[model samples]
Target chain A: MTTLPPPSPRKLGLVIDLDTCVGCHACAVACKEWNDGGQFGPLPDRDAYGAEPDGVWFNRVHSYAVEPGSDHAEGASNRCAGPDPESPAPKPGLTVHFPRSCLHCEAPGCVTVCPTGASYKRAEDGIVLVDEDKCIGCQLCAWACPYGAREISVRKGTMQKCTLCVDRIYNETLDEEDRQPACVKACPTRARHFGDLGDAESAVSRLVAERDGYALMPEFGYRPVNRYLPPRPRRDAANAPPAPPREETLDREKLPGVLRWLDRVLSR
Target chain B: MRPTFSILCFTVLSGIGYGAWFLQGLAWAIGPICEAHSAASGVPWELCPVAFWTKAGSMLALLFVSTGLLCSLGHLGKPSRAWRALSQWRSSWLSREGVFALLTFVPFVLIAAQEVALWIAVVRAGPDGTVALSGWVSQGGLPRRLLGFCLAAGSLATVFCTANIYASLKPIRAWNDRHVVPAYLSIGLYGGCLLLAAMTVDRSMEFRDHRILLTGTIVLAVACAWLKHRYWRSIDAQSSTTTGHAIGLESLGTVRPLEAPHTEENYLTHEMGFVLARKHSTKLRRIALAAAFLIPALLAVLTFVLPRVYPLTVWLALASGIVGLFVERWLFFAEAKHAVMAFYGR
Candidate 1:
């Protein structure tokens, strides 16, 4: 039952705009508030009042200091610096706030790795979820997830993860605008956009194309439905073009007409 | 990779248990070959009485296995829902391991039951040796060869499943390697041979050529020791991952953690962000190897030279071997670096 489903037409997911995210953690808090009262309600907590407080939450945010300029290990990471100079020579690092959650991968190892028919992906919306009733809580799904999406709750005796707000997203009773995920609704900067990514013409899909949105850890080949729109290049750096390649044929007029014709055909 | 006690206990006990079973099976299967060779040599050789050794060895393996399984039960959050673990064998290695482990019990139970019945038969035939129920209860001879085949197949497959469970995990670089499966197989075999030699040398006075058994064990120990050393060395040589690049911020230069998601350690940190100190891990590695391989091999040689101290030597060897396995398994979990650590600055 944990077997992956065939490719779905409606790959409903989020497109997080990293450039606009203020690292407020509003969405993260709202996610907990909404989910704690939803179907997978009241996320388990342990020693809440004790010295070491621990609990299960669907979303978490990480803050990273990114070093700008050269020495980019990955090709995708090479980008020009920001235009606004805080100083004559500013530090080469920019603070980046990263939010971590389930990617709703096309080939989710968490689902396949579950020994029980608990973890599953809906064919209709491609939202990966867990059935608490069926989960044995072996934590194998947690072990398999590269994104650290799954969380094991000792109190509930089950593994919990991002449900993509299935209950709220499809609820007919709620206002149409408020029916989206708690995280998206809570994002004050409007950095989070949710829609069918599989539909190439969808607003989210178009945003992805325009912003050059990319999947995280594409090398792992999970083909995550949720895409992240990378932070934009710095203002001045975006406009500045580095030294361009020189013209190979400096003396175009000096070349023989026959040779020039041959050259043109070869270049074409 | 937090070195949880339940999982550590499970791997240590089951690894040794299954390893011993594999050896027992090998001994049984190869016994006939030895006999034939002896016949060709015109020595009219006699084999050490393996009936008692086989029985005792199988029981010891079963005891360790049962205890290991019980320990794993505590690790699971929903123990009552444990039955659901067997439902996904088609895609899950854990399920395959569970199914294989259950299948393996059949052979162990059969062997243990037969051995017990044989002992009971011996007890019933009083000093006079003629008070027994004759051939009724002792109908068939212990089917060592057939049962040995079952033991070998079942135990090895189970170990493979265990190894694959870790090897298939793409997140942990240390675990998701070609070396993992072979390492598990090697360590399992090494542990088994150690247990077999310990039990055999301790319990037997009839084994004429203790040299052969001891020598084989010594070789395996030495080889296993070298393999573990190389494994540790290789892991050390590898460099840290380019995390700045991994998080899609490489162009920004170096990526460093500015703040963690939580003020205190959370589940992800507790579970995946384990980092063992280099100096301490190196020391532990040496200690584990010394106990598991070096000491056991030396003890085997010592027994060969001074058969009088055989009991002390073999028991000491067994104790040390078990301790070594615990350390080895602990390191396997503790030393592994998870990919999720890229975000947490592990």
Candidate 2:
């Protein structure tokens, strides 16, 4: 059963926009909160009140500093000037907030490497999942995965991973608007988009195409379904448009009615 | 990768077990065929004290194998459901290894039973400490030969499956190396030779009588030494996957970790993020090589010169080989850098 199912056309996956993520970690928190009591309940934390708290999490966020034009063989060129001659345009370093999770790869090694049939890919939706009942918790699937998506729960003695919120995505109990993955719904910046990536015309697919989204470590050949949109060139970059003037004051009229009232009250 | 004690025991102990079983099978298989030819020429094949020692060795081999299997259970989080692993032999190498490991017990049990029956049938001490067996004891020549060959083939095949479990994993560049399979096999067979030499050492037989076992030990020692050297050299030269590619940010320059997702080490880091100092690894490698390959090979050669202390030398060699192989196995897991570490900015 660990053998991969035939590739399905309805690959439900996510496309995240790196340029919009603020590294707020709301998505990761929301994921933990929703899944804590959902179908995959009790993501147990060891030493909850003590030092060195650790637990299983389906999603995690990492931030990195990306320096433009510093990817050369010569090494980091953080202070190097932009191409503008009249103005000394110092190239700025960009901090990219990266959220890591299961990519639901078409050819995920995690499934194939599983000794038990616990880890499997759904032929219906191309979503990878683990059957806790069958898992021996050998953790080989975790090692097989290059993404570090799988985690073994010490309390449950079974492997846990991002299910893409399978319990919520298709659940009729929840309102239609709230029936998507917890992470995708909780992103304040609308950075995470979820839909059928297999369909070329899907919004997530178009967003990927317009933003030039890419799979991480494609050289490993997992053929991940989820894609990440790279951070757009910063305003100070040589080819980017000129920066706009700074805003000196907030316009109360432009703010939403509730926010405007709150602003006025805070000002008083 | 973290070098868990249970996994090290499983691989090393089982490796030595299969090695001894393979050697025993070779003797059983070859002895019958050669005896068949000798009997056709009206000559009798003498039964020596080695027959008793060989049976004892077989029992010891079974003990090592079973203990190794038991140790592997400690590695599983859900040990009770370990049998579910045998359900996926069609695709999983680990499953295939489990199936083969279990299947190998068949030939072992069958051969051990045959040995016991033969001992029961021929129970008489001759003048020169040689046991005389009835001529009819050599009956069922083809069946015994077939079982013997099956035993050898099964032992090697199971070891092959075990090696493939690590070699097939593509993410760990160190484990995925080409030399891994051959290294496991040569080291395992070499361990078997050491065990056999120690167990089968008879005072009645001349030290030169152990030429085959000593020669095998020396050959495997040299082979394992060269294989491990090449394996280490290859892994050293291999460049790890870059951080830029890991995060899909290679177009931007030199990505560095600004902040980790968690304050404390997570399971990923704890499991696959082992770090070994270069100086420590180099020292350990030298120690492993000296104890495992150098000392054993020297002891095997010394058997010829100091034949009086052959028993002592072989036992020392076996002891040294097991300890050295344990260290080498630990390094095998400890030094391997998993690809997931790239995301952690390792």
Candidate 3:
């Protein structure tokens, strides 16, 4: 069974909304808290009190500031800015907070590169996992991973990675509402959404369709089940008459043509 | 990219060991032509008896290979679980390598046993005035021929498997190339030839065809150096795949890393983000080239200048070759930039 399994029918995964994320790392903290006592618990730390402190965490948030007009060539500055080619205007840049974990890719390179039959991807749910007992901890799996998902725990002397909170998601003992991944449930901004992406009618799929969700490093061809919604372009809202006071707009629209029209627009 | 000591030792030492076994097999295939010119030249064996050399050479090869295998095991987190590595040879290059290296021991043992038997018979038979070339290397014998063939095939396959381990990694653009296997093969041959030359010349004796062996070593050493130079140049001129392209962020804008996920170093950064100073690397490369190839080649030429220099030159060649290979192997790992490092902005 070292060979890869056929594609799973139910690609259960998460979709993250970049526009709404505040980069508070609540999800990352929640993930550590739950998983520490879950399947792969006590995700150990070393030299905690020393100058160099290192530990393992399934979810890690990375912030990136996409500079304005950095991608544009010299003369094409205004030509390709503002997202759409027709806009012909530059847009202000915004920082994006990326919380990364195992993508549970359909073709997980980490799984295929294992010398021992330690790493595997589940055909039922597309969750990539490591068999701790079987792993020789050669760290080759980490090398094969393009997203830096695989981590070797020197303390445990085995490879570990995000299991997508499998222990909780399928646990029938827990209440139905609490069965979701720890990160998704604890996200304060409600930026994380989880559902079966393979289902056409799934809410996550609809969000993906609406928000133009994209795969990270698609060229690597991992075909990650997770998707990220890019930050929306800022609305300029530049052209407008000065608004009347709030109390004045609330008054009845009995006025001259311009005032009435402005009141109506403001009220609506 | 971290250039761990165990791995550098394993790759370089094991390569020479396999190369030696393969050449011995080739000599077996070619019959007594290899041994005829040696003992018959009335040359004196200044080291030990010729039988001792035959037995000792095979032992040295086994020692090299076993030490290398053991060194590699040290790098594994669970050395006790190393047996599981052989399970996935059908799909994994590393699995295939473990299988092939283990399989090579069969032929290696057989060849060594044959040499031991021959040596014992020679010792019991006493100093039979003329040490007939036909007495030792019975190339026409069916058992020896078959075993030699197996040894050659097995050794070559092991080398190929080792090379494939690096070449199969798609993320390492420098390793995944046509140049990798040939570089490994040629270098293995060169290192093996140096070992062979050193063994062929007995410090207590002189060999007539020692010139031929050392000459072959020179040729192989030069070939190894030339191929390595070409590989280095190719990698230097190569335009590596960018992080922007890796992340598919080129279409959006310059994909600069705003911050690392962790403040402290993780396994990925420690292993993949290994960086060596350019000036130090260049200095090391020079030392490796001089020791591994240049000095050996020059000493080999000096063997032609006078017969007295033959044994001394072979010893120097062997010494320099080992040092050179070690430095070269270190550079191989140190210079390699893993694709995963792109995320860390390495």
Candidate 4:
């Protein structure tokens, strides 16, 4: 009987700070650039300039206007709401920008459903990957996933997903500073972080403790490796600004000719 | 999920094949008799309507079923490695399916051989259309009986295998229930009835048996419709496991994401997080009905009403029914909501 190798203990993960995020898509672009050039083949784009545009990206950011009453904004007060003393008004709505990617769950459903054993979690870091040579393009694993993490590469007829920049993270050639994921390195606001989540004393672990981090769709029980810090609430309603006037009432007529010309140029 | 054509064809084609085979077997077992007379009176003994129609129907059904089974194997990346699938009988339903499907081939080939041999013998015997076989012969009476048993057993086993494949998925709430077994079996029954009707029309057989088959089809169709409706409704009522309360603080009665997890779409978003509006689902349901049940039922009725116009009606019904069943199967997979969907914040 063949004895299976014991699973490795390394648990790589991401820690995201909701408080500092500016919602810039630099991380997404950086990820695309890195993953597209790495060991995995190029991610092809279909009808990029057409009416229906679709392509592969390792990271995607979503903007949500969360109300104070919503569950996602439960602990956090609305930043849009004006700070007022003794006012019974509910917290004003705030636009929360969230970035989403594969959680690299502990219990990955995508790995198990593969009929050909093409999809498997790495014993070293628990990173899920598809062995393209062994994959028949059946896409059963895509159906089995709850996170919608897997996408069928139309060109390759094989499933593709976020690799967490696997080649870069483990490369011995790269310096320690350059070893992090492309997304983490490119994050403008330092919102995205990468480290070993399994280590309690790790920076990601400390951030998780201090910030009350949350997991996306924890109900899936996949136990994603990524952690998201709840958005920090803006204190004091007195510091808030009033709503902007309607567009029709704006004083467009008072603008000078040069300013109007500049405005038109900027608008275009 | 990314739709795999191989699997789609397998389910639809196999469904048609099994239906035809089962009905054909039933017809063979129960000789045709007049409903009004309660006897075989006035029925042409030489024609043997049920036997003739069932045999013809099953032949046609086998063509599609065999092709479908073969095509599904193409989905594997390493086709040669497919033999390994049979090794995991205890844990994997997919492995079990492969074994049963492979086993089915033997019986199907034997039955076809037996039927062809019998036909050739009949032709060689001339005008009497009679051929006698001695028990002592190796590939004669005993072999034929063994082949028949294999065919029947294999067909039933295939159906069971297909059902178990879906039923085994514990995470898919809609597929995991007890209803899956009966629903799959009924689909087979409905398919058999359609094939039986086609064969009867082709052979210009008696109208009475066609009527019984049509009635059976309608009953099965209605039962399927009810079961599907109930399954959808039940799923809708169930609360998601990932409730706002589960996360700790419950100030908000309902928790919805204020911001998505990412700016760029990831693997999870493309997979389990698919959302189709209720309106579109209803529209698709109507289309499925028109394709799968309504048109076929009407055709079956028309075939009974105008026996001389049987050919057009039978062919049209079969074509429409096959297409309809395909759409139905597609929806079966598409509409099924997994418990894991709750994790995607669906």
- Candidate DockQ values, in order, are 0.51, 0.63, 0.51, 0.13
Q: i-RMS, every candidate?
A: 1.2, 0.9, 1.7, 5.5
Residue B174, model 2: lDDT of: 94
Kindly list the per-residue Cα lDDT of model 2 for residues B1-346, writing each as its tens digit.
9999999999999999998888888877777544554456454443544555566677778888898999999999999999999999888889998998898888777766666666665553433455544443442355566677788888898888889889988899999999999998888788888888888747544433257788999999999999999999999998988778899887787777889999998899999988973438999999999999899889888876777776888889989999999989999999999999988888
Put down candidate 4 lDDT per residue, B1-346, tens digits, no spaces: 3235677788878877876766554443333333232244554333334446556777887887888778777775455556655654544466667777778678667667666666666678787556564442213245545655666666777777787777766556667777777777777768767776766644453456767876776676677667666766775665555523332223324444555544444444454444563336777777877877888777767766777776778777778878887777776666666554443356
The clash count of every prediction, one per candidate, is 7, 1, 6, 27
TM-score of each: 0.86, 0.89, 0.86, 0.72
Q: Per-residue lDDT for A69 in model 3?
A: 45
Question: How would you encode candidate 3's per-residue C-alpha lDDT over B6-41 as one tens digit per residue?
Answer: 898889888988888787776666546545644465
Ranking by TM-score: 2, 1, 3, 4
Stretches of model 3 off by over 4 angstroms after superposition: A70-92, A236-268, B35-54, B123-140, B202-209, B240-243, B277-279
Model 1 lDDT tens row, A37-99:
998877967998888888887888888877654533333232334343332343544777888
Q: How accurate is candidate 3 locally (lDDT)?
A: 0.77
lDDT of 4 at B231: 60
Report the CAPRI category for model 3.
Answer: medium
Quality class of the docking in candidate 1, CAPRI style: medium
TM, chain A, every candidate: 0.80, 0.82, 0.81, 0.76
| Higher-ranked by TM-score: 3 or 4 | 3
- Identify the runs in model 4 with alpha carbons over 4 angstroms from their true place: A1-9, A47-53, A70-93, A198-203, A232-268, B1-10, B22-51, B66-99, B120-181, B201-215, B235-277, B280-291, B294-320, B323-327, B330-346
